[model samples]
Target: MRSPAPEREGDDTLVWNVACPTRPSSVPGVAMAGFSDRGRLPEGQRLIPHPAVTLVLDFGPAPPVVDAADGRRHRGSLVAGLGLGGALWARGDDLACVQVRLSPVTAGAALGVRPDELEGAVVPLDALWGRDAARIGERLGEAASWEERFALTDALLARRCAAATPANAVDPEVNRAWDRLVASRGRARVERLADEVGWSRKRLWSRFRAQVGMGPKRAAKLVRFDHAAHRLAAGHDTARVAAEGGYTDQSHLHRDVVAFTGVTPTGVARASFLTVDETAWPTLPLGGVNAGKTV
Candidate 1:
């Protein structure tokens, strides 16, 4: 049974319209989703910025295109490292893709590469995986159905995860720190996190940035902003959202929202991207009302 989940649409083109489930339990810090966008639109998509690194595997006629804020162009099945306040413009025809979100914790293992190498950049998957990336593409392209593709992806990730040791693969302390930030809804202080992780402030700062793609302070701020953005989308008042989201005041909250999304808090309240997230990633806090449903 296939379903339609429209990510965005217009008179000419469509992507992400087929509704489906992204089982989060398949891999740590990784979620699976698929989108089919065909037809030529003058523009394609503006990636909704999230804290997670996105690995997109495209099996369309031509690879998807990504124009980053810093004037970099990327194409094909690509891995986007952790981002800070930027949108990737995706444009082209036949933009079918399967995307996986990798938590900084699982990046080293799942990617067989390091997040630091890709931070603030988008690179073809082959760049990291060499021949394996091509093999995966061939397998995905030959799969008869989306379900099969999803299963293959799951198996690959599970195998990698099994091989990756928590301590040896990446800094376990950094993983714990990230968990704390997520648990606290991004409100946890880096200094406090350092104390808990048994690292000095400077060591934590350097190592966290090296592995996670951004310094701890910046990552925390981005996490906090994601939380606030969701609250605003859920129809909370700006002032209340601000206070609850850990801003000094409404003005502080306003600045952060604008900086992150290029929109005011009120503007974010009307974002459809967040609305789509409810069904796409149920475990995400933005996924409140639509949690645990597969269409």
Candidate 2:
């Protein structure tokens, strides 16, 4: 199904046509959203850092462009690692693409590289997948409808997963730690995770960083920030969100919001990135309890 996405570029409200897949992906830990804009795309659309790895397949009349905080500009299809640190802005016109959010546990297998390699960086898809990236983009452009595009993307991911070697598999203990963090909405303690996973704190931290692209504490914080940000976007007061999100106080929440998003709580509430979640991610599929469920 397709609908107009609610978006805001600062004070100016903008809309982009958003499309969702008819069915969930056959691959576990994967969710997809398709976006198209025949008119001019919104400028300065800040990308909020989420806990999942993001893969964007651009196949519109013109490729999309992402400007980073360091004055680096990335064009065309790209994959961003988990915890982007809130410094990326997307700008383009006539944009069309399928954006996939992958659980870090599954990202290594699907991307043919450890998630750590992509940490906090946006790399062109071609850099990782070589010519295969261009071929997939071409197929997406040639697809007759959004459903076809979704199917094509899903199949590609499934193929990649199937071809993954033993070297790419995530350690089961690391997966358990991630699941616990998600289940607790990022309130899980790193020491407790290490205990539950039967590993020393130091060991768990190292494995998680190597496999999931971030340490346990940082990952948990990102997950917590994601939950709080969504609640703020839903119009909840900062005090209430802070209490429910396990913050020590309103000030603690404010610091975290600023640290991750470069914005205050009110600013995050008005952010187009968070506002569009309802239309773009109805399943809310970012590594919940059923993260690795397959079709």
Residue 270, model 2: lDDT of 84
Local distance difference test, each candidate: 0.71, 0.83
In the range 73-96, model 1's lDDT, one tens digit per residue, is: 887888887752365677887767
In the range 1-295, model 2's lDDT, one tens digit per residue, is 7565545456354546889887889888888889886475646477778888889999999899998655778999999888663557888888999999888899989999878987678889999999999999999999999999999999999999999988789999998899888888899878898899999999999999999999989888989988888888788999999998999999999999898878898888887666666677788743222244331
Which runs in model 1 stand beyond 4 Å of their true positions? 1-15, 19-25, 38-41, 162-168, 266-271, 287-295
- Model 2 error, position 5 (Å): 5.7
Off by over 4 Å in 2: 5-14, 38-42, 285-295
Give residue 15's lDDT in candidate 2 (0 to 100): 49
Best by lDDT: 2
Candidate 2, after superposition: displacement of residue 146 in Å?
A: 0.5
TM-scores for all candidates? 0.83, 0.93
